[model samples]
Structure formats: C-alpha cells, structure tokens
Target: MVASCATCQQKAQQVKAMQTNIDFWPTTLKLKNSSDLICDESLRYLAGKRLVCRGRWQQRTVAVKLFFHPKSAKRHWLREKQGVESLISNQLSTPSLLFAGTLIDGTPVLIFDYLSSAKTALDVWKELDNDEARLDLLQQIVVEISAQHRCGLWQQDLHLGNFLISDNQIYTIDGDGIKSSTDGKELTTKKRRNNLALLLAQLSPNYDHLATPAIEHYAATSQKNMRDLKSITEKELPHIRTTRRHKYVKKAYRNCSEFIRHNSLRQVAIYRRDADAGLIKQFLNNPDQLITDGTILKNGNSATVAQVTIAGDSLAIKRYNIKGIWHILKRCWRPTRAWISWGNAHRLTISGIDTPQPIAILEKRLGPLRTSSYYLCVHENTPSATDYF
Candidate 1:
C-alpha cells in the first residue's frame, strides 16, 4: 500500500535515529529544488541540511527518481515491484522498502533509509589509477552478478552505474529493472550472455572494441558465483554431521548454520549487480533457446525472439546469435566455472570414486565451437534439484 505523509514522516524519524552520520530532519529543512523535476537534481537538502534523492521511497530517505512523465508510472511500478518480490521471495539480500509514492507536483518519489558509504563501481573506477585494483573490483561485481543468475533471477539492467559498493561489498539500488521465473529456475543463458557483454563494455577502455581477455575474465568469475552458490545452498547444507548423544542440540546448530550460509550467499548474489543486453550477447552464441515459442521475453534492443523448447515442455533453452568472432572471445571467460569443476573433481578423486559414476566421454571435433577436447560425466542424484530448493 502507498504510505501516507505521516508514515513517511515516521520513517524519516526512524532513519534519523538509525543513521548516526546524516540526519534527514536537519534543523534547516530546505527544499533544495523548487524547479520542475530534473534527473540530476533528484537529490536535495532536507531538514537539518541532510541530502536525499528520488528512486525508491520509504519512511527514512526517499529516492527522487525522474519520472519524466506520468503516463509511464504504472509500467515503472510493476517493474520495480517484480524486482523487489524476486529478492524477498527467495530470501535474497536487498534494502527493504518503506513506501513508494508521487509528490503533489506529480513527481515520483521513493523514501527509505539513506545508506552511508554505498558507492557504485563506476564511482570507484573514476577514483582508481591502477589497473589491478580496478580489475579486482570488477571481479567481485562479476561474482555477485553470477550468483544472482544462479538464484533464478535476472537483473534486467545490469550496469556499473546501478550498483552500490558498501563495506567492501556490492549492493543494488535500482530495483526497477529485474526479471524472474515463475518456478524460480536459474537465470537463462541469454541473460548471462547479455550481462557479460555489459561488464566487458564497462571495463574496456575502447568503447568501439571488445576485449577478449576481459570478457574471458568476467565469464570465469561469473561462473564462479554460480558454482559457489550451488555448493553452499544445494551441495553442503544437507551433509552436516549429527550426533545421537545431543540430537536436538546438533540439529539446532545445523539449522542455524544452514540458514546463515544460504542467506549470506543469496544476499551476495542479489544485491550487488545489474544486468542488460550487452551481458547476454557475451555469454552465448545463441540466446533463442532460453524460452518457449510465442513466449514474450523482454528485449532491450531488436525484436524479442521466440523461445525454444525441448521434450515438449519439460525443458526450455534460449539462444542468442552474437556477432563478430572478436566479440565472442572477448566475452567467454569461465574462471569461476573452472574452479568449481576442479574442486568437484578433486573431491570425487579424494573419495576414491567417480563423482558421476565415470560417465563416458564422447570425443567430437564438430559444431561452431573451436574446441577439440571435451568430456561429459553423469552423477547419481542423492538429493534432487527440487529437494535442495
């Protein structure tokens, strides 16, 4: 429900108490902008000479987003709500919403606690001179992005500007551009590819040229986020050793630990990244197999492609036809995936058995992919996919 002015005032008070750094209800109480709503001027001084902006509104500090026109308010609201619901339903991490509303002047406003020390990667990039330091920051971002996809959610507009870095970690501020699945499956391949492209573009110095090494680096890290989340939530949670002597005590400890781990991973994945068209292009050569035919998928540019289905309806795949050989290599890093693969392989070897019963490795030097060496293995399911979720 839309919050009332009294509720907004109460929220502002709570935010005042929580934030020892900035006071929203400063003694001065200045309405900094008397002009019509401007995008950059969305932030202004409030009571006690405190600063706040427009975006998502709540009781504490409001996000003064540039609505531009009222005709689009309904669309924006639905998009924002979908994004918020995905994170909240999955128990993923993000800032809680206090309220959303429009000003008397027809300007859109969102109020919530004004976070301290939350800077975007782009904000940090401008401050750094060393290449290594910048790369480290981007790597963390890619990791977070990958985690988000693994959780069956997509950041519809993944970009550096939309992310906020606080306390040595990342947080997402723009919730109006997120996508999700009805059944909560992992993000589609198309989404991953587009996100990688966006990351590459942002990190690259040459706007016109795509960097193969940078793309590869991002892909590797992105894959790592997925693997890490899977291991923690799906793989490790159920295996906690228990003792009969202290059954209740052990059970309680296990439950608590699992909750902490799962939520921690979810927070890392959901709150720190933004996604878009560029990223999807980098991760896949074809993004059409991700959804079903006649299924409406959102597209940033160009027409939305029909979804491809396998085995009638049980499985669906989305594919993208990425252009340029140089572009493809620049966006295919798989470091995180490799690490997880190696770790899994090591664990199986240590157990003196094949992890997937040593499934046959079929050798093939076919298809557009330029790889002559590849292997596939199958494993018995102890706890199936649904069980873990």
Candidate 2:
C-alpha cells in the first residue's frame, strides 16, 4: 500500500497480478512469490481486500507475511512473536523478522528475512548421494541443536525445515517453536511423542508391518539425540550408549549408523565464518534452550535448481547455499514454497500416507557452488527398502 522506489512498485504490481485469477491454474503449479498471487490462508484473508504480496517493509528482497487468523490472546503466539522479533532485532543470525501484524481476519501475519542459499529438509535428503555426509550432518545437527537448547529457547518442533545449515553452523528459521520456558527435556519428549503419534495415525492397519522395526529404531535414535539437552548445563554432552533393555534405543543407533554409512555428507569439511561466530556463541553458553532440525520429507527443491528424488524406502538429501547478504535476499523473493512443501508433508504424514522418518538435517558451507549444500534424511518409505540410506 505504500512505496517510495521502483523496486517497491515492481513488487506491488507483481503481488497484484498473482491474486487476480489464481484459481485458473493448478495448485501444483508453482509461481514466483510476487505477481499478485493468492495462496492458502493468505488468499482466504484477501477474499475481500485487494492486498498484494509486496516484499517486506524494510528490505526489498524479504518476503511479505500477513496473518488473518490470530491465536488466542492467552496463547504463546503473541509472546513468541514478540520474542522472535526481539531476538532477530538484536542482529541474531536467526531468520530475519521483516514484519508482524494482524490482518482483518485476525490471523497473525509474520514477515521474515529470506535466505536464498537456504534449503529444506526435503531438498537435502533428495540430493544426498552418500551416507557419510548424511551422518556428518546428523552429528553437527545434534551439537548445534544442543547448543540452541542451552540458549534458553526450547524449539518445540525440531523438524528439519526449521533451520538452515551453512558455514558449519545451523541458523534457525521458523520461530513458532521458540519458547520462554527452560524445559528442554520435557519439550523434547513431547515433540517426539507428537511426531510418533503423527506417524502412527498415518499408518495402515498393518502399521507394524508397514513401518517396520526401522521406524521404531529411528525414533529411539532421535530420542537419544535429545539426551544431550537433559541438563543443558554440563561441561560437555553425556555419552548415551545403547543398552540391552533399550531395544528401540539399540535399533535407533543401528539405523542411524546405517543411514549415515550410505547417505552422510562424506568428507566435506565445514568452514565457519567470523561474522556468524557472535550469534553462534550466544546459544553456546545458555543452559535452558535447545534447537533441533526440521523433519526432512520427500519434496522441495535445491539451490542449483536440480530435481531431487527420495525414491524407494531409503534416506535422501536436499541442499542449499547461504553466505553474504545477497544470498539471503534471494530467499525472501520466494517465501511460500517452503511453507507449502511443509504443509504437504505434514498432511501426508498425518493422513496415513507412506512417508519417511525425518531424522537430521545438515547445514554447512563447503567451498564453491558445488561444495556448499544442505542435507535432510528419512529412514524408510514403503514395503521394501531400496535406498534406505
């Protein structure tokens, strides 16, 4: 509605075009974020008003988010929204907060900094060619997420898409899960249960046969990944070796080891940048917060725009590149894709569709375009295990 430059005007016009006749095409067909498009709930909110999907208020490249439905006032939505804004405002390397306001429909709209080099969980697993890199990514995720928990924010949902891996450190993206409480252990247990329920709900009458022992194994391994956050204040993470009584635990460890052997990131060395060190250090010393990876499903695209596949019941990989300001800018230009992909995966997983157990996400900066990448993986898919890396 307001503008001062040519870039602003271009963005405005594009948003206008996207909404005009959105129903004319297939939902599967993707479009540029601009161009006046109506998408999901945002489209419902714009039913009467002719609002455009303009870029963020301060940055020309950031995405514009509008909320038409507001969570209960007593709920944590408002509080978390404020918290996220404050965190990002301090120049924290987390996702940039561009805008937050309530639409006429009462839904809370949130705009965020877009990282172009960012890749989703689906992207990484689909592109992953080996297991070593996958295992390496998983290990880094465990360390980084453990560090986040120490920062006083419990990322309720540790799914893969919630973070971006670049420069050997994980940068959190979604903040809905960030909380004020220091209940890392409790939150981890709840999230694990939530994920399990979601999986079971989507399985068939032969759930056991369909999910296989590997599914339970993956769950136990994921559970162990959160063990480091038990106290959140120890000098170092405690060792969590598999024990006999913990059948699921043993299965989980075996599954993780196998998955890492096939789909890991290889000998790719992680390169950390000086600029990101400050943000990384903030959570490193905290004792109450914990961060976890988003679940990588079987969809999404990559930076090179390469087509990826998690065919069969094997783990997959998806990757992206993030570095300077320009790269982050590119991510803002298109914000709906990740949200959309995430929605689809959640729906499929909840609707009894055969999906994989998303374990870890790998975010790191290597070297050139070929070296920089992101990775997310799953355990198995259907009846048979083809590439269950």
Candidate 3:
C-alpha cells in the first residue's frame, strides 16, 4: 500500500512538471541537489520534447538538459547517465556530469560542467585550409574513436560535430549516441569496420588519401589486425554512402534541418537551409533580370545559363526556358529536368562525390502542373571533368 502511494505521487509530480512551459528562457526550476536552477539560454531545442540550456546552478555556470516528455523521458535520461558513466569507466574524455536526477517536480534533468571556450570539431575542420592539417585532425579524431572502440563503446551517430575541442583536447559530446556492442571488451572486427566506415562515408572521395592512413592509425591504436582493411572500407563505404544518400534525398523535398521547402498554388520552391534567404528571394523574383545583368555562360533557345555573385558567393543559375505551347503541354504536366538535376546533385553530395552544391530549385506551376524550372548551384571556376581527364 505504501509503495502504491509513492508511485502515484511520483506520477503526479511528473504531470505537474510537464505543465511548466520550456519554450521561454530565463526560467527557474528547483533542483533536488543544488540551488534553484535558472536556465538563461537555450543551447539546443527540440520543440516541447527536449532542451539543452546554459544555466546557473550551485553558484556556477553549468549546462542543463531537461527532458519534458513524461513517458519516454526517463528512458533517455537513464541512457545518457549510463553513457557518461561508461566513458568515465573507460577513461575516455567527456564533459563531467555534475548531477543526474529528476527535478523537484519529477522532470528529468541533467547538469554538467560547461566548457565555455570549446569549439566543435566541424568548425575547426572548416577553418583548416591545407590537406596536411586536415589529415592531422582526422588522425587525432580516428585515434580517439579507436580508443572508444577498444573500450567496448562507439558513438552510433559518429560525426565531427559530436566532438568538442578545448585546451588542445578532443572531448566527445552527445552521450545519447554512445552505444556498447560488447560487454566491456574490445569491439569485434565487424563492428569496428562498420563504425569506422560510417564516419569515413561522410567525407568526399577527394579525401581518399586520408582514409588509408586513418584506417592504418585505427588498426595500430586498437591493436587489431586488419589485413583486409582496404577490402572492408572499399566495400562498406559505398554501401554506407548509398544508404545516407537515400535518406537525405527523402529530406530534400521537405522542410528539415538541412533544407527549407515552400509550396504554393502558382509556384513551388526548395532550398538549402543555410542558403541566403534574401538573395534567393531576390533571384527568384527577377531571375531573367538578374541573368540579363549577370555574366552569361550560355544563351541557347531552350535553356539559359548565367553566373552571378550574391552575398559574396559566386553562384551559377540555369533556367530551363519554356520552348513553346507544345513544350508547355508536355512539360507542364510533369517535373522539369532542372528539378531532376537538383535532386541528383543532392544525391551526389550525400554519396561523398564531388559536385557543386545544389542550393535551390524553383518551378513555375499551374496547380500541380509544372512549367519552367531553375536550378541554382555554387559556381566552380575549374575546367570540366571530362576535358581535364
């Protein structure tokens, strides 16, 4: 009878906490172990479900993660706690977890020491200009990853963004992605191959030279004999790339983190989320005028190509001009070649192939029918691959 009442009270507390709105920042909450926690800035947010914020706790600035969902929150909370504990037990570098427990009202909360000056590995990699520096960075990253695999753990969503650099050290973040495939034993050869391939697949084939040395370093650090290292990565990289390409292609036509999608009765548009919205709007509004003012690359009857500079970015715009009334009758009932190229370009990108990024695709439409379409991409000054080869 006493146990039943405790369970009921816990449920009640969770319900009360769920009522507390998380969308607004500078909100205060009572922590069970420390002072009243004040969440001042949202570092990352996922609607009503999860929030990572910088907050004040115990007279110190700390990072706080609050899980608002009632049913699934506890599971994720325990996973994060277990992941952090695993890293600590394995002597891997990660942010120290200060506290892990429910809030006063039973909302799951985790507090950690915040590294103020840390930059994500992705940002640091982007700043590196030369291939040698980039290779050195990759070496350091794969070595750390090899250590984790040896310790019987690997990040399921391994990527450069999950690592933080501070004090000349790389600290892995996103505890939730840390997964164990073995019972405190080194990962099996198959697991190591797949995990390493997943990370390598994120890089273009232009980095092919880096992959050999990186895998060699992994084998050396993990003490694993990978006589078939070349065969493994060769077979696995394409498979991973194809899988990722398929997934990202599905996101190309929708509003996701990487792409912005807009649709209307008269027009439909899709663009990269990181693209300059003002420039895109201006170009789309007066594409012909811009093409007239910009440098012309091609001026054929059925198509036109122009190079334009916008917001300091050199861009190539191609307009698939409407041929005539007969062309409209056939093309208006279906998607244009430009739309196809836009999706194909994204496929190439996701497959770790070198190609200019497809920034946006716009189409003129009558209801569901499509007419003239435009494809936008980053301008490349190099010679065509066929001619160069």
Candidate 4:
C-alpha cells in the first residue's frame, strides 16, 4: 500500500487538530489586498474547516470566510469565487465580493460587504411560528433557488442557512457550493430532485407533510410540470438520512463539532464539546459518590439514576450496574445500556426530535471490551404532557 509522505502526515495532523478547537474567536489578520483587519465574533462555523466572521476592513463592515482546510482550502475558495461571480453575471441578488485575498499565514479568505440587518433563512425559519408563515419562508427560499437553477447554477450546500434575508430581499451566500452545467443549460429534472431532496431530508420531520407543497412552490417558480419530482425527491431522501446518521454516529464518539473524547487503556469517555472540563473531571473522579449526594430518582440493582447539580448545571446521571456474573459477562463484551442511551439521545437530538441534551457518556472498559457505563444529560424542567395538557 502506498503511504503518505511525512509532510502530508504532519499537515493532516494540523488540520485534525484545528477541527477540535471550536473557539476560534475572531482575530486581527494582515491581508495582502487592503490593510490589517480585525474580525468580530464568528457568524457561523461549519465542520471546523470553514469560518464566517463579520469585521471591519478598509473602514467598511465586511463579512469574511476563512478557509482552514489543508487539502480543500484553495479549491473551495476558487469555487466560491467563481460561484459569486456567476451569480453577479446572472443578475442574481447576492453580496458583491469586496476582495479575495490570502492571509499572512497563507489562509485563503473571501471578504464581502456585510449585510448588517440580514439574517440567515435558517434563522428566519425559527421565527415563523405558524404554518402559513413557515410556508411563505419556504416559498421565498425555493424561489431564490429556482432562480439559481434557471441560470444553470446550483448550490451544492443547498440549505436554508446559505440564504440571507434583508428588508424582505433574499440574497444567496456560500459560493463554494455553486455548481454549473458543462454546457450552461438548466439543471436536469433528476439533478433538481436530488438537490431538493438533500434539503428536504435535513428538515425536521415536523415538515414531512410539507414536502409536497414545497415542491409545488418550486414547480410554480420554475414554471414547469414537476409532479414526478416529488417521488424522485422522496426516493433520494433515505440515502441522505443513512449518510447523515452514519456520519453523526461517528462524531458522537470523537472530538468533533459536537463532542469530545478521551481515550485510555482503562476506559473511554466522551463529553459534549461545550461542557465544562473541570466539572467533567470532578464527576469522573467519583460518579457514585456524586450521585449519592443528589436526589435519587431510581435506585435499582441494575441501574441507578439521580438528579445531580454540577457546576451550576442541573444534570441527570444514570449509572448502569453490573448486576451479576452473567450480566457482567454480557455487558463487558458490548456497550452498556448507558452507552446505548447516550447514542440514542444524540441521535434524537440531531434528528430534531426533542430530548434531553446529552452531556457525556462514560464507558468503563478493560482494553477494548466494555463493562458498566454512565450517561449524563441536561435535566430539563418542562412539565409532563399530561400535566401541561
């Protein structure tokens, strides 16, 4: 098998290390085009490889994209540049690029006029409390998307977040996803279906019934008969779900956008990336003792659950007991119930099904095999359905 060169290996490690640092706060950078710019807090961070921040450049408020991915940084930057240029050429409403420059550290960055009053379509989605308001928002989004499709351009990352709304005017962002046809023709029906399905599959299942109406809006905007696209879109959804589920399940076990992991021969522990490290360390030292001090919800031989307060956060921690010799042998070779619960909680969370926020999962393992485990989640205070009703 061919092996990567040492330089490639070092760069890969650096990229991996950067992904773990989520607090990549805005900072000042010396640019090649204008002058040194100071960035404010980040606008959005995606998968740790790309960052969007708004800051002042050349005495104007500007939005910036800093590409830090070692392998795809330059390529994605070029694609983004091309996409923005294509949108402008097609007369699409989008932020005009002020300058494309490289940082002193050789990071590729794009600077644009910051839309001060604008909010992402995803943010707008959150405020639409009624079905009519939501469908209107979806119509606006698909209309803009329809315009892009008509111009032989499509966003690969075709999600609500890529569009921005300002004064009722919608503008597209994230040019890296701009895809174009070879012959500059409109996207085919199947291509449109898949792209639409990508967005649909990611939507919270609360909107499952809205998918057909959404397509109707898209069809009306496109001015075509697209009754078949609905079926095609539905057919494409499972693939996206399977892919997303597999990717998210992997992230739950490692130091990624959402969770952090600590590996050792004795045990493997994963905690929420935003969780307090000190509190986790304290809880790790003696979880049983910590539970003893809290209000016990269920004190059973097989499992114990308690309402514990740690570092000012109300948390519920469940400890899966070993029970007996047979139980110990069975669980030792596989994931404890605590481990499964942790995974399921996160799965529900990412699917947008409401569940308690999972804070940590501890697997007490002997080398590779596992024994008893503990699961920690934020203690929610919402009333039960029966009581609320």
User: TM-score of every model?
Assistant: 0.41, 0.37, 0.75, 0.84
Against the correct fold, how does model 1 do in TM-score? 0.41
lDDT (0 to 1) per candidate: 0.43, 0.38, 0.82, 0.80
Is 2 or 3 the stronger prediction by TM-score?
A: 3
* Candidate 3 TM-score versus the reference: 0.75
The C-alpha RMSD of each candidate to the native structure, in angstroms, is: 23.0, 22.5, 6.7, 4.0
- What value does the lDDT take at residue 126 in candidate 1? 78
Tens-place lDDT digits, model 2, residues 206-272: 3323222333344344455434323321211111111111332233222221122112333221111
Error of model 2, residue 193, in angstroms: 12
Which candidate do you rate higher for TM-score, 3 or 4?
4
lDDT of 3: 0.82
The candidate with the higher lDDT, 1 or 3, is 3
Candidate closest to the true structure, highest TM-score:
4
In the predicted model 3, the residue pairs found to clash are none
- Provide the clash count, candidate 2: 68
The candidates, ranked best first by lDDT, are: 3, 4, 1, 2
**lDDT accuracy of residue 143 in candidate 4:** 88
